[model samples]
Target: MSHTPATARHLLRRPDGDTTPRFSYGADYNPEQWPREVWDEDVRLMREAGVTVVSLGIFSWARLQLAEDVWDFGWLDEVMDLLHAGGIAVDLATATASPPPWLTTAHPEILPVTERGETLWPGARQHWRPTSPVFREYALRLVTTLAERYAEHPALAAWHVNNELGCHNLYDYSDDAARAFRLWLRSRYGTIDALNHAWGTAFWSQRYSGFEEILPPRLAASHPNPTQQLDFKRFSSDALKDHLRAERDLLRRITPDVPVTTNFMVMNEMRGMHYADWASEVDFVSNDHYVLPGPRSLDELSFSANLTGNIAGGRPWFLMEHSTSAVNWQPVNRPKRPGELARDSLLHVAHGADAVCFFQWRQSAAGAEKYHSAMVPHAGADSEVFRSVAGLGRVLRELEPAAGSGRAPARAAILFDWESWWAAEQDSHPSSRLNYKQEALDWYSAFLDLGVRADVVPLGTDLDRYDVVVAPVLHMVPQPLAKELTRWTENGGHLLTTYFSGIVDENDHAWLGGYPGPLRDLLGIRIEEFAPLLDGETAELDDGSTGTLWTDRITVTDTGTEVLASYRTGDRAGGPAVTRRAAGRGTATYVSTRLGPEGLCPLLARTLQAAGVPGDLPESVRGRVELTVRAGADAEFWFLVNRTDEPAELPGVTGEVLAGDAPERGEDGEAGPLVLPPRGVTVLRRAAARG
Candidate 1:
């Protein structure tokens, strides 16, 4: 075993590796909510709570611009001065997330009308129409003004463009949006003939002869075609991207040096915007992750972290929003049990998060988010939550500058594509029960259980370095991606794709030849017919265990292909559920049904081991505990976090830091499992070694 040096390089790092400032401890602070007299107290409390940076003006558009032409920065200027005087950096928000009430009131076109044709009333933020020219002009003006004013501010560290975009489900299908959609289609297809072919409109007597005939697919009396729906999804996503690009371009003109970013909500699908497309324009990706109470919260966090890391192209990311204690949303809002927040924070760091910031500094006094958790509760600085924030601040102050100094190294990659996600969801044949995220979670959980360091990459990424690649629900088989996967499998790289993979083109149209489409040769299996399972129905696998959801009948096409698990459902009661094919020096595995963990985990483990990848972590690490590795120049840091309240012991051979001693071993010469108190975390540094 190569003794991994316990070095600082495994930690998160600045872009320059020297001059770029490592993200410091921060929280979203809306001092504009409070009076000027309260500034000193808030600053003092922030200093106590270890907040080195504050994200300001996130939802202050209405306040900043009370009138059409008048702009007010007097209070904002004072807040910036006070924060700078107190040695705290500011992530200056462009304040474009929400338009001022006047803008919406004066120009109804800027207001987003829902699918039901209900125009959003005033006061709600994120209600502006993405494609509205008035919105575009005004939003750009706000961004330009902020950039020009704060471009040289000594306190400014970065620019936050608006709050979370696309938070709401509504997208305008108004006349303005319709015209914009036509323009977007014109740019994409160039001619109506190509658009007709892509949409297959000839089937429904919907072939458009002119660009003016096109309209965004809005809710109609009849059920809309999947192709039209998919196009609308794509159009809305593109419109939002165009909005971001416009603001980003203006910001770049004024402040070319400071990084610009926007906070994105995780697992949000309505807008059809994936991180991959946004990553191209952003300096770095930041996400607001809300952990709902459940067994899968940790897994969700890991998935999000991996997604962000992948979007950054192995670059470090920032945690834009996390709860300090209890969340305000959810029917049952529960507080974080003891050390859960800290443990989650460190896990973010271990998973390539350069900075960790909460949603808020002080608790809200009014509105929908009044009860949301914050570093400072309504009780002020004397509260226990305040003490916890202060304690965390102390730890971060001591550890962050050094610990957040490097990126993690990963060898395995999982491909996540938005086109695939959209295509899978739009498929009329497959069971509506076939969820994309659940399938992804199944594969991601397997990787986590095995302690494999894998990056969740996009479809178009370079895959040469990865030893194994997993593509779940790859419904949209882009030609380039199909070729890349073929090349990868042919080059001795192991590949695995799950049910609902490789079924459609970019237009949500089924591939002409066979199921798995372009990947059929690589998979060596031809899917004949898809079988959808009804609710409360179950089908058994060849392993004699029952499975749920949809199943498919598959036949081996090549001599190298072999059935691993067979489905027992409908007329194809004994059909293969999983199949493997030897392609050149490597192999490909195809799963035809959504299998539960019992049927999925063991199969994944066996496949990974066959591919010479580590399939299991030490048994001493509890099943609920998640372990991730981040490598540095000399050392690798193992972040072991117990996301639950149950006590879990650390694996043997690891030294203890919080307890300040080497771990004691059992009779087996393994270190005694360290009991992690509920929501507790342990970070162990050891020599980087390959199994």
Candidate 2:
């Protein structure tokens, strides 16, 4: 319900007497990894690359604190001073991301325990448990030390909390976690009877007489209670959030002028924390996104960036970290092409990122990530990566006028809910192949394939702003949410949802009458059973497309309902595959099968037309270029990205070229058609246009 208290632009560093907002460009600087002489060269190359800021001392806990009684700040103080002298600001970290060898050696009880009752050792980062009192005491002590030391430092711009909270240690089942889970359950349910009713514990003699008897869903003989697993996921996220609050409060108390933030890993499968709930806790939102290699890689990148922008409430956010080239973690690390470095960064900026940064500044010669690319790679400044970085810095400087702008909302949106994602993927589901995020992403990819601009927003966002909304795999629908959707549909808003939606309430209890219980009346369809398909099997539709993963046996129950597509082959032959029902001036559509992004294009085109949602680009150039817009007070900045490896053209586009590949000039010196190079991006400052 709450919004960001401040914006990243207000806290970032800028030139002297320059009222124009500047976009920040830099990478994480780890001076501790190199010799003292190399530090000077690092600063020189940083200025050459036009870096404005760098996140310092993220994984330096072991070096900063040698023992319980010993502390060192001599080297860090010098680095801070040197960066300030070089006209670069520092995002000072708490240096508590990982526990030192001495701390873990002395307090092994703070280690995390797995669901199989195995203790996690301290070789890797994030070995400490979120619920451990001993871990909190030590971490907070380190945080307080950093805040007090850098409270008045001129180079201090913002406070960086623990790096990527809950990235590796999200699910802990230790004794401390058990105690914390009990307390969390008590707060949520308030009574033992209430907890019992909510968890539906009477099925396998799993009912508990008191809150003390409740434990986290550990490994058992059979699958754990579904609600119990869901609640534990919630509690685990909350536990990490509580730690973030603790560190943030200390920083705020010490340096009230500086903003506090922690980087969220919002990329693929990093769903341990509910970022929509965590957004309001910090002063501003920051995210670390990495490109995943697949058929829909670019779509996934845009989807994550769009979701991050919405999570920040359309305000400018910081891109904390991304890869310059191939990441070291993937099984087969392939180096990035020539133009991908700048294209990726500019794409994030188009989605409302004011600051662009990467994982590290220089390539490491002796670490786990040695092969990972950086601004200055192993070949040094003469390399192509460094040249691209320098060129991007110049481009960012030219686009200063577009800074601090908000993302222009689109006419269509895809509703994303974390609770549904967590609840739908349990062990005892009807099918193990059901992936909630992939289904939602398929719709997004379809939108992009049609050249339609759609925002991927959270569930609670105002639905009235968009004419069409698609909610995919919304399995768990509480009663209030059901009513909310119904009201929106009745008010002349087009609604589209898929199979496995509205099957259960907040307590994960199935609706007794039929499937899709709450939305049955609105969708005008009744499903008595679900038909899950096996792997390598697919059902054919009358539209000449095949569907995989799932299908629903439907019976039309309303007079206004019309079957748009039907199943041609399967157990339920000649049945309705897709149906639409009229509700007031709007329509409610239901899809009972899984159609991938390519297959959904034909149907989605019709849906877009019915809802009066038009694509931003011309039909001829659709699917070849991706269009994103950001609105300033007086003008709009349009970003046209070439999605393929070939040259693309756009005719009759008028604007002032701000950066990237520029369009040709007409005979009379007017703006002409825009020609985008292969894997290129062009930004144009145009007159105030439609959002």
Candidate 3:
């Protein structure tokens, strides 16, 4: 019998290999929430709804373990058997999402403690601290029990670890966490002297005498030590990862044939858990995403989906959880407009989602998430959401033809780092307005405007694949990583970095000699001082647009570099606001100001041209309608979406309609505009002609 590997390249695919369902649909199934009499009906409805896979027992820890040393698998066994009989597969959970109430009561210390020194009450779910040994022991016991019982169940398809690790208790400042933090620091920096130096603790006489003396950056007299905070974030992420690894090992030892995955909140990476670091541990990656409510909701979805797809190494991933309509958690839960359900789901597929599913199969009658939309809405199967759900199930089955195709390779790459995201805007900086994520999204949105499907990749990913790399706010740069980037640019990879990048090292200490220290040579400029503006202030630029938030007084050190754009009217006016240098065979463009999309978009366009990356300059790509194209060896699929309520038309486009049929191509393959209805999405697949 074949088994999942225990290392990096484990069962990245399903256990059954190519025979695994190409397109699967389902929801988080909680049979334990309902009576046994209802289980049979749930299974029947699942079959009718075309749910081939069900994620079972995600939050049933309390029910599954009854009492310490006493177990109850009878209900679960019945549920699994009933599901299999109804032709549904299982994404079985270890039931470790939350510890049983008895376990938590016995060890109240297992409940997470906030940085403010308040112990979290256990009324809600996932209350256990990530670093708590008591929590891990109980959680692992539950994991072992589940794995042993369902080692080779016919219904089992994948092993799901604890639900969204560190979602609630990502930052726990309890005694258990303090001990773990010291150990983590010892491993990262061997001696007390090294730790002191890295943290620059000598400032404010904060020098640590020993690792044990160090505590989490508790409400400091001033801003907490930046490096201490950074390391704490690092340690917090690692503690949760270590727990996942242990559970994964236990599953592989038992149900070695099944692939294992844990759902990720990849959109936010909430607690600084660099998912790029955790990507290799999971057999296959799964992500839970909800649309960010705003005018740019669709754009956010596309950006996040692309980011998740890239994090999966461009492999197809699972849409583990998305609300069928409005979600209960947001401040203003807006129900999805008609046609939005299918459009949003297909958007993920266009990017590279192999499976599409929602957070729940049935709506909860009571609970915190009772109001959240579901496939079987509270209104019943005849509701609009239910029809959309059933229609999507059929639509996904038809889209099975496109499953497993690789994400199209890109000519450009964007560096989106979790470390930079964490440390860049930490309390003490030139501007509290140095928004790391906004800068990234600006560059990414500009790329989408140019019809460029740039990979929003991690910093550590290999650079050889793309001709152009865009690093927006790469605030922290380690020497080794800088050297590698230097080599890539010298060997002919075009790079573009913005104002706040390359300023500090991992420890939040300035890079010594210059503002953008490690990257000074590549950029061919030295920034003498930071000149960030107030929120309302703006600096005029040569591009006819204005820069905001941050600016730098830059001086060109090398004669070979050229000035691309300069501040027209400011203290640093015409002092090389943006500079470019020919680094050997390639080029490096540096922007020394916060040039929003208005200023950065054109600069990005020029860089794309220099890098020889081809893309259309159509109105659809640049306007309210967003266009993305995915290509397979034999076909090209175009996803034309109208982001606004107004109808949009894509000029000179022609293809066979795969979804929404679009408005129309010209007569019989003649080129004409592709019409998109209000907030509509269309997929057009053009098959390559035979030789």
Candidate 4:
């Protein structure tokens, strides 16, 4: 196998230059799966593949701790010493993600309980309840042991707190959870009357006399109260966060110098946790991401990568787990096509990932994840998967120059809110299919198509940073934030919001007065009623582009609002489907329909141009490629990536190709249009004069 130069990875740099390399590469290592003889072979192979770090012992508590008091560390000590001898760093795990089977057998209540009142068995990992005191006692004991043993080990890099917190047990509905829920409500509402009012429990004679009467909203007689559901989601996230904080605090107390992080599963469907509130609690952010195996996989991957970087305050984050090929968890796990491995890894780097790692180093011989692809596939070191992994490792090392570069400045930003997603996805809504995430993705898809970079920002982030702010399906923009957004547009920041926006408050109650409550006056429009279409139905717009899934019948309350495009078909025909109104020195645009990419691209391009946001790309690479810029204090690195299978061309300027599938040179010192191979990625450094 081929390899890059041996080096550690980002993001701390001391004045003494005692820092590791800019990029680190490795995978999840579980030596407990193999015999002691295989451990030496594993390290040898890692060295050959340029592996610098491995996340160790994420689920090894059973092996480490035999009983309540009995403990064993001889094996883990050997593994750490072996990795250090092989010059590999260890991202040590607290081994709290999965508890041992005996613990569950002894204290069955420690396991998470389903909404149906069934305790989740211990066969699967992370079976413990996040809010249970017994689970906390055992998990923290394991973490304390690991921290004390490996705090000063030479191989230590970072502390992985617990594997993907709340992946399966996010909303435990046991009695413990009920008690915690009452406490959480007391803290939030301060009084039973306030809780009753917020939950709107007066409607069905379901009013609670006291905080203790409130349950987990489990197995409701009918559709659960929306506000209760939303709060439950918040409480679930906070519960896990509290556990993580406890584990993190213990890890830090033992090893204050080592950075600590827990991997988050960030995606459109996985919306249980509100990561915005949890971002500041970690030493650094790490994410576990996987493409959903579809046509829009690249776009979704880019969106997630950019979102991860943005959430980390534009700091270079760790790609803790992604696949080299097929992941076993998916129903129809599709293997990555040729050239996709390097392409996918490089895309994360373009979005400011300092390290690229996968779920595992080797495939399991037996277990649930036996079919899951790893850095070293079951086919051994000579396989195509290993070749790709080695190749990506090489390219990551080549990305040293742009390793610490932050996300380039963007003229546009999109609001990705957890509360809004939860509220929109609640049952008994106007439409159960109303996807808050897909709508946000629609706007991001337009940006990607325009070859422009946009920040996927949080709701509370400063609005003054971007010229254009797009909030698609912001179903619950509270009054204070709505006022802030209004001030932003009035101060010359172009604001864009979509259907179902400003309809609800933070409490999940509809904003009184009108359809789009707080934003109506600022947007210069009023939505009378929603006109959501059935699954197979679609409507046309004035520009001949089609909209599906949703549309709103809007009226121009203020004459200043300009109707850019109206619904050309349906009972609500001639209504303002899209409108733009002048707010101070800028525009407040609203698209009251799901216009997919076909209808959204041209509209966004026009809006961006109006906002003076540059979005020019080579015609050949316009739709089939991605352009991401990482601007450092000294330079700006422009990454041009080909997302299609066919060759793509991009008008090239004078710059050095920092890495991978470089542009071909043309005559007279004029670089020709960049003809990138299938799934090719190239980074170009702009001239200092341009900077």
lDDT string, candidate 4, 253-277, tens digits: 7877677888887764778988888
Global CA lDDT of candidate 3, please? 0.82
Q: Evaluate residue 403 in candidate 3 and report its C-alpha lDDT on the 0 to 100 scale.
A: 69
Q: How high is each candidate's TM-score?
A: 0.92, 0.98, 0.94, 0.96
Candidate order, lDDT descending: 2, 4, 3, 1
- RMSD versus native structure for model 2: 2.0
Q: Candidate 1 regions off by >4 Å? A: 1-23, 268-271, 401-406, 568-571, 655-675, 688-691
Best by lDDT: 2
Q: Write the per-residue lDDT of candidate 2 for residues 246-343, one digit (tens) a residue.
A: 99988888877677899999889988799999998887789999898988888888999999999999988999999899899988998888789999
Candidate 2 residues lying further than 4 Å off, grouped into runs, are: 1-20, 666-671
What is the Å distance of residue 619 in model 1 from its true position?
A: 2.7
lDDT of 3 by residue, 633-688 (tens): 68866667766678777767677776775554356975456778887877777774
- Two-way TM-score contest, 2 vs 4, winner: 2
Error of 3 at 605 (Å): 1.4
Per-prediction backbone clash count = 12, 0, 0, 0
Worst 10 residues of 3 by lDDT: 6-15
Candidate 4 residue 632 C-alpha distance from true site, Å:
2.4
Give the Å shift of residue 228 in candidate 1. Answer: 2.8
